[model samples]
Target: MPLRPETARQVDALVADAQSAGHVPSLIIGVVRDGALAHLAAAGTQPLPDADLQYRIGSITKTMTAVLVMQERDAGRLALDDPLRRYLPEAAAAGPVTLRQLLGHAGGLQREPDGPWWERSEGVDLAALLAGFSVTKVAHPPHRVWHYSNLAYGLLGGALERVTGTPWAQLTQERILDPLGLHRTTYAATEPFARGYVLHPWHDTLREEPRTDSRAMAPAGQIWSTVTDLARWAAFLADPDPAVLNPTTVDEMCAPVILSDLDAWRGGYGLGIQLTRDGDRVHVGHGGSMPGYVATLAVHRPSRTGVVGFANSYGFRTGGIGPLGHQILTHVLDVEPVPTRPWQPAEAPPPADLAPLTGRWWWMGTSLDVSWDRATGELVGILRGDRVSRYAPEGPDRWRGVSGVENGEVLAVLRDEAGRPAALDVATFVFTRDPDSEP
Candidate 1:
């Protein structure tokens, strides 16, 4: 469904305000719902003629690079826990930094190469970049802290090419971009692209920024995209195309692997994606900045609403691109609320075998409810402290925990000789109907 006229105006107003306040040369914003474009608006210092204009989406390219890595992992070509040294022995100096750590920016690699600024000057080839690797590249011990490293992603992109025998760009094009019909997103800027400009701090002047190809480091942030294509990509991240990536893998990409901010539980880093918490609302996406362009893509997963923002201002000190996207999304959610699905009875009642396990169990004098979910075909356990755990049937009279603290733990159902409920043994902890009863 299209956005209401009034709601659309409000969203446009937000974009216009951001452009004026941030001194952006050009700005474009789009919202997606149900995997379709809901609203799009643009503001520019010059009269805007086209909506398909591209902006360099900086590190946001890492998300796509990460997706390709996950795709390779899914195809059995590689594993997340595989050490970097396994693929490229040159990286042995970094020690046991796994693929997962590199993706999550916990690989302890330096943020950039020790050489002169690669983003400004044309970068060296992948082989030359890798040959210079030394233990000094290991900034912090592997997985000790979150260190944003463009070099790590560059290595990952090269590793992907080495493992697949296909260029990283081609792999991404075939596996992701083309599959999702994001033709507008490309490695180089196309016609009608916005000119990246650095907003002068003191004077009312603008300096054009060069679009340098980071060569091997291109995977870190290289693609040029428009809000239109990005809105589609955002939708893909939320509701993935199974042909490109498994929905489960996409979910893993959105889940936090390490904390980006230690003070507040506000931010974390996932495999390739970035996670943000705004009160109870959780957002998954990434932000990018090139010489003269800044871009952001954010999706409120629960609501299936997303916002994409692009501005042709190099590293502006205003409210930042992520927050702009967040504000637009929040405004859309507030004005155009997604109707909640009304509760309805299940087509069939709970299974007969699950009846005995339905009520309650006691463990260590605490009560836990073991309930069956017909929708998910799993047994859910609710502890007194409200820490809910989900378990799926593993075998006869046995269940395996699938999520929460009990994930991977086993729940063994003990039955009396007459086939009556007696006690449940979970990870050696016994739970019975009577708290005082012995195992």
Candidate 2:
């Protein structure tokens, strides 16, 4: 009743593959669907068969921190748009950086100031960490682009402490971990912590390393948790409990704020969350990576499916956990695979002879090349340099795609004073036509 028959087999195969490749000393995977946990599997050893321990969850800590901030906001203690200086005056002189900017990684702060603390220092007090930020310069104009910064969250942790008159770690436990009944999850410094491990480059050997304490950057990454505990966290993300954070606020946290096109794994970043669309359904969650551990938690809200995967070894790389988790969810839901075609705006008819609508349009910073089929008197919209779709006129300036995923999707064309197609607003994407484009 927990997992679909085939899904259990698929998970078994994945764990076996990881074991054979020595990618992970141990792994724990959990899947939840329709408000209930479907499966929880643990394989391998915590410390090579001698120690039974859980792994550090690296950057996944940020997601928990983000949730705490939202909880405070829900209680009317603070606002997301409040300037960092509003909470901590030390940041006032830096510039106009807001808590929203910090959460979305748009604060223009460096990824990690004072060098990599994971490799360098044991731990630093909040005051010492904030002191180093004085000389830290902005990398870009605020909110101009997406730049992952651990330090920004670190500063956010300080802001929370200043606002609440408590330490970041305590605030998280009181606000999130404790209320959620995440008994097995706690700060890395807690008792029964798992020793971190790194895989040697040359041979099939894993070396146990001292666990790095990120007290100063605790907001960025500093939490230890087991797979079982993460399963509950994933469930909360998929269908939030209003007592914690309102469902709408959770959705807003997972909504896209910036586009990440720098790599093959292109997606959007929300407030401490990542947004990736799998066909019509959007997956929301976040991934974590530290020196010796990698973890990913994602949820398909529409399907009420969530996956949490954790690895013990540091060098273990599985591309990204989000896609893998999504694949598992699809398999469970029996959903068809997502096509590689990029989403495009709907098409519209030309006002006169199908001439006025034949042009390029930009929608939400994405362009869709549109042309008129003179012979058929239809409109075609091409997306992502490929994937052709045809549209038939439905109304004055609205058209509906006849085939493909865009089929049945409506398009509304915007016109300037001259009555020419200047912009196109599709179901959700907005497109602005190229000026020089001719019909």
Candidate 3:
């Protein structure tokens, strides 16, 4: 569905304000809902003739690289817990770093390679980059802390190459980009691409920044993408299609693996994805920055709503492209909020065995309610003023709590000698039909 006129205008004004206020050479913003573009707006002048101009997505590329790694895991090629030395035997510096640590930025590898600033200079090939690794690169012990490491991703790319017998870019293109129909998202800048620029701090002048290939470190941050394509990618992150990645794996990638901010959980690192919090809301996505380009993608997973934006100029220190993108999403949410659908009766009746289980029961004189969840086909148990758990059927008259405080505990319905319902025993905690009834 199309966005409301007022909402669209608000988004446009936000983008326009960001471009001028940030002194950005050019900027593009897009909002997506349920895998569809709801709004797209561009500000300032794009140097390219085509409207679909790609901007260097920087570390957002890491998210795609992480997806490739997960794909390998899903196909049984490797495991997340597998140590880096298992594949890249030469990476003795961080030999204990597992694939999970690398993905979640807990590998303790240095933030950059040993050579000159790789982003500003030519990048080395995989062989040369790996040759430069040393024990010093292991800034912290494996899994000690959350440290952003472009070098760690570079090593991961090498691992992917060894496992797939193909370049990381090729694997990503075939497995992720092509399958997701993100043709415009590429490792190299295609035609009609934005020319990155660095705005002067004092003077109102601009200088074009050099774009490096980033070669071996490309997996860390080298992809270029347009806002439209990124919006679709963000939508995919919110709602996996199963063709690119199974919904479960996608959820894993978005799960918080470590805290980026120790004081409070305002920021966190997922499997190759960045996590941010706004008030009580938590969002999943990634931010990118090359020399002169900056971009961000934020998705409200609950609503499957995403906002993506990119700018050509490398400006701002505190609230760069990230806040700009998040602001767009926040505004859209404020203007056009999503309403939760009201609960309704299910069409199918409860399973015959489960039918009698629904309703109020008493456990140790405390009231509990059992109800059937048709959505998941599990029996939900709510302990009054305590906890809630989902129970999955185990066998005849037996169920197992799959979640909550009673997780992994067994619940069995006991019957009298006449085969009539008598009592319930959940991990030895007896429950009766009547609160006043004795055990």
Candidate 4:
């Protein structure tokens, strides 16, 4: 469905104001909902960009690289805990650094490769990168802190190449880009791309910035993408498609590995994704910045609403274009909130074996209610009124908590002598049919 005109206008005003006030040469944005582009808007100087115009999407490339790595993990080709040196022996210095560390920026690697600035200048191959890499490159002990590392991704791409026997670009193209139908997203710039430019800090004048192949560092920030394609990608991140990547693996990737902004506690880094908070909503996404280019992709997983934005000017400070992109996401949610769908009744009941487990129980002398969920086909535990958890059978007389409290913990069934249902033992706490029963 199209956005309400009032909603569209409000979002447009935000875009126009950002363009005029920031003096950006060109800016474009796309609002995504349920893996579809719901609206698009553009504003800037003369000749505003379209949804298809590509912009260098800087470190957002890391998100894709992280996805690819997760794909390998799912396929059993690699594990997150596996040491990097197991694949790339050259980096024996950070030998203990695991793939998980590289994806989460917890590898303690130096921020950039040693030599000149590769963002503007040409990048070297993995061999050249490894030659300069030493123990010093492992600046801090693994898991010390969240240190953003372009070098870590470079090493990941190298490791991926060796493991899969496939080129990084080709592997990404086949695995992620092509499957998602992101035709406008590419490893290299295409024609009619947005010319990246640096807007003078003091004046509105623009200077074209150089674009170069990141080579081995391509996995770090070499992607060039359009707002439309990026919006779709953001939507995918919000609600992953099982055909491309396992949704569960994506969940693992979004789990906070460490907090990025410890004080505000508003920002964090996941296995590979970036987590940001605005008011009460948390977005799973990443921002991109390269010379003369700024871009962002943020998605609200609950609402599955997202925004992909790009600007020709790389003029923003530490945040780059992230603040604006995040604001746009928040705005869309505010004015064009997703409509609620009517709930449907279940067509089938839970398994017959679970029939005995449903209904009232008691835990720690507190009343507990248990029911079967038709939607997820799991057992739901409601304790003390509000604590809800979903459980799935793990073994005979045992069920594992799938979500909410006691997640991943086993709920062992204690049967009566007659083999009828009795009390449940979970974490030393027992649940019985009698609410008055004391522990």
TM, every model: 0.89, 0.72, 0.91, 0.94
Candidate 3, RMSD to the unseen true structure: 2.7
Q: How far is 366's C-alpha from truth in model 3 (Å)?
A: 3.9
List candidate 3 segments past 4 Å from native.
Answer: 48-51, 342-344, 385-430, 437-439
lDDT of each: 0.87, 0.74, 0.86, 0.86
lDDT of 4 at 349: 68
What tens-digit string does per-residue lDDT give for candidate 2 at 271-340? 8887776666677888887777777787887667788777766655554444556676666666423224
Q: By lDDT, highest first, what's the ranking?
A: 1, 4, 3, 2
Per-residue lDDT over 1-439 for candidate 4, one digit per residue giving the tens place of the 0 to 100 score: 6678988898888888788777888888888888888889899753469988889999999999999898888999999999999999889888589999889899899999998998999988888988956898987899889899989999999999999999899998999999999999999899769888876777667789888998999999999999888988998898899998998888888899888898999998998799998889999999889998888889999888888888988865234468888887888788777898998887776677788888888965787788988766678888888999878878898889988897898888889999878987876789899877888
Task: Please report how far candidate 1 places residue 43 from its true position, in Å.
Answer: 1.7
Task: Give per-candidate clash totals.
Answer: 1, 5, 0, 0
- How do the candidates rank by TM-score, highest first? 4, 3, 1, 2
Give model 1's TM-score versus the native structure. 0.89
Q: How many backbone clashes does candidate 1 have?
A: 1
Where in model 2 is the C-alpha error above 4 Å? 46-53, 189-193, 262-265, 317-323, 335-439
lDDT of 3: 0.86
Question: Model 1 Cα displacement at 230 (Å)?
Answer: 1.3
